[model samples]
Target: MQTELTLNERHLYLHRYPTRQNETLQAWDAGDEYLINHVEQLGLPPAQNIVIINDSFGALSCYLSKHHNVTMVSDSFIAHQGAKANLSRNQCVAITHLNTLNELPSDTDLVLLKIPKSNRHLSWILDKIRNTLPANCRVVSVNKVREIHTSTLKLFEKHLGTTTTSLAWKKHRLVFSQLDASPQPISPFVEWSVDGENYSLKNLPNVYSGESLDLGARFLLPYLPKDERFKRIIDLGCGNGVLSVKLGQLNPNAEIIGVDESYMAVESATLNVKAALGPEFQFEAKVNNCLDDFAPQSADLIVCNPPFHQQLAVTDHIAWQMFCDAKQVLRAKGKLLVIGNRHLGYDNKLARLFGKAQLRQIAVNKKFVILQATK
Candidate 1:
């Protein structure tokens, strides 16, 4: 997979963000190729303010940065890292980076966007574009032809103004839109209250388990390991930091850290944590992949509601990595608790990572299993 990808007469190498696993996933997709090809074929000139949304890696940015001033904006922290890694590997100049939902630059004219899996996410991006872009600005969005639908076109028309599509090329289609300076529109972020948790969780369009408290996490909450009081804790895949907020409130002496791969998740979790712990508490939320940078045996307890997939593919590599990293960061006799779907078969994986692991049947619900492993 490490080979030259020629786009717009330029060559570059790209990889998906690091998985720390053996998944053979390509970094870029046909949509990426289609968008670049469209601009080139149309004789579009490069400009100083080129904004790219969700360029999974640096493929688009690296190739375009040669002439255009590029700014990379995404929600995934891993994508940002991958873009930077590939940029350095290609010896390309560093590009500006911004997390999703951030303020769009005042000089933005040409926008390159990739359609996300979530309609909510796409809606938010479109909302941001509508609020920021100048009249007559051009936005080029692409996706696999299979993903394009009437609703997709409606989003473009509703948010950005007039829109049209190019004929399918290589099973991908490019969307062309011009800013219409339409009336300001609003898209609301979703909010839900956990039934018994006394917490209202806010979900950004792209955060995991956005519709509600994930069933596994909800099931595991009542059974949270309370065998002993812990002073240092980590919430591994803390979706909205609800677990940490609750944990912080319950354990007065504990200092907590919540980490997620998505910057939007971390931001949502941080807000929840603040509302729960106030300003004087010792807790922080950060965007990180597993426990990559944590020192060995630094946590007294680790809690996780691990993710089973990355991007479009469903896989358990992320869960496996999280379990292994939890063991590395847990103090001697420190505990790691995770909630997962019953069919995932995480017990054996945890046993392989830790010397021993136990499965707890904490509920009558047959859909989920809570696994606890110790270092």
Candidate 2:
């Protein structure tokens, strides 16, 4: 994939985090280029306090940090890591990084936003921008033209004020808005419950399937293994810690860990697991990219519901990476259990990683299937 980003007649090398040799995707996209070009065209003064939201990598940060004081805000651990790596690779000046939960820097002079896939997440961010930034601060955003609907523009106008869009360039568009609205209260966490369980789940705006238990999780809940042999377990890509909570209930002796990339997801998971299993329970939630830093051959069991998409792009690389990581982290004879949509063909991928003889089907339904792979 393309690694060189040519901005203002200068080239910067960028890569996605957990950089893979065979990776075929680039770190930056047209939206990033459009924003960079727009900023260059405007000729903003140096040393401005700029806040960049949801930069997929260091594309905007690395370019802007050269002359501006940049602060990046994002929910993704991977994106943060990517930005750091790319910035260092290009020897760019260091910049501040913040998670979605952090308050915006009070002295912000400009905001550069990359529109996210989730409307709820966009709304949450817009609300925060409205509540935090000065009224005169200019807010500029970028996204694929196809992704920006009337509703999306209305969301910006509703939270901020007087939003408008530029003509499409390279199938991407730039959004401009003024922060003229009064500070509005941020939305509360969404709360829901399983049909017959007493457990209550609370999800931050960006957590996957936050409003309700998704179909795959609903189908796999009843079939979660209750074995005592599993002592150390991980819920990979644990969105709201629902799987970890259930694992805690089933395997009381196991040290349950919930791992996800999103800060909001990790926070929601921690809160949900604590509420469901209590503070005394042996459970931990972490924000990480898959099992990147996990110990080799350490886990006794790994229960995963891998995500099929990264941001707005629908791809199976995440699931493939999760399976690869699971294989490296599983101890001898340790098992990995996964639930995925049948069409995703996770069974074939698991078999490829674990060998045909080591993989087995645990359960299957109309749309979902549970597979087990022993190492």
In model 1, state the lDDT of residue 135.
78
Off by over 4 Å in 1: 19-22, 357-364
Candidate 1, 244-311: lDDT as tens digits: 87788777678899999898798888877777678788888888978999999899989988888887
What is the C-alpha local distance difference test score of each model? 0.82, 0.91
Clashing pairs in 1: none
Worst 10 residues of 1 by lDDT: 355-364
For candidate 2, the lDDT comes to 0.91
Top-lDDT structure, candidate number:
2
Q: TM-score of model 1 relative to the true fold?
A: 0.94
Give the per-residue lDDT of model 2 (tens digit) for 241-360.
Answer: 888988999898899989999999999999988898889899988999999889999999999998998776688999999999999999999999999999999989998999999999
How many times do residue backbones clash in model 2?
0
Candidate 1 lDDT for residue 280: 82
